[model samples]
Target: MSQRILHHPVLGSLEERHSVQFEFNGSVYTAYEGETIAGALLAAGVRTLRVHEETGSPRGIYCNIGHCYECRVHVDGVPTVRACMTLVQEGMRVTAGSVLPTPLKKGGHAN
Candidate 1:
């Protein structure tokens, strides 16, 4: 089942929109034009957007708006993109963010 809101209390019903194809982590998925990347992924039942940069813990959408960057992902070879703020485009490529290496001190110890 899709997670999309088909009917809104105030907006009534959903309007027909063009469908677009996008790739997420090597898997192809369909999204509606003008829809945010995070929205499409959520509708497709994708909860985990990325892993924590430091701890390698699963991170998903915390804020639908652009304030919280928990939904950050790689889009079109670009890194650290806010999926909630980015619109889904045809042929777009989205990848989950990976764990980043910790910074090292001059003494070769992790900072």
Candidate 2:
């Protein structure tokens, strides 16, 4: 995954925050303090957060204000947590939302 740090031309380098370890899709990732899960995922170059249960289509962060439900994910066995609204914490375990009964294979859609 590519580095997701942004270099603002006007604001210059952003202040560094303490790094924390988190897990996404069973993989450990580093996230900075005060950064939302969505932001950390984006920084890690992750786009798709979950698959729509009905349509089986991939969904990602949208709206980003806790209004839209597009960025839902399973965090620590809790289903339907909003990625954009949740803050990353040390040892956090994040997983993509799954379809009930069986989860659709990655990149696969319902027939």
Candidate 3:
């Protein structure tokens, strides 16, 4: 299989010195240190970042930088982390969902 990838904007002119291996959705991924998880996932063609709380809607990384809060994931047991802001470390564990407990809104008391 031939895979083509676009480099992240931050890696201007300098080659990635260290390549790290990690997993996403049980699948293996290789990315450079200092790169955001979302950017790495995008380079690997990971289009869906999350599912809606109740609708099961699919999501993907957008706005390579962390501004949209679209590529949120559970990183190393931490939830609600922005994939675009979190750098990928070797052997890091990540899950596809919000780590933060869902707030109860039955009476509009919590969010």
Give the best candidate by TM-score. 1
Q: For candidate 2, what's the RMSD?
A: 6.0
Q: Which 10-residue window of candidate 3 scores lowest in summed lDDT?
A: 1-10
TM-score of 2: 0.83
Query: What's the lDDT for all of these models?
Result: 0.94, 0.88, 0.78
Shift in Å, residue 87, candidate 3: 0.5
Backbone steric clashes in candidate 2, count: 0
What's the CA RMSD for each of the models?
2.6, 6.0, 4.3
Q: What's the best-to-worst order under TM-score?
A: 1, 2, 3
Q: What does candidate 2's lDDT look like per residue over 6-72, in tens digits? A: 6788878878779999999988988999999999999988999998776678999999999989999
lDDT of 1 by residue, 10-32 (tens): 99999999999999999998999
Instruction: Return the lDDT, model 1, position 5.
Output: 90
- Model 3: which residue pairs collide? 49-59, 79-99
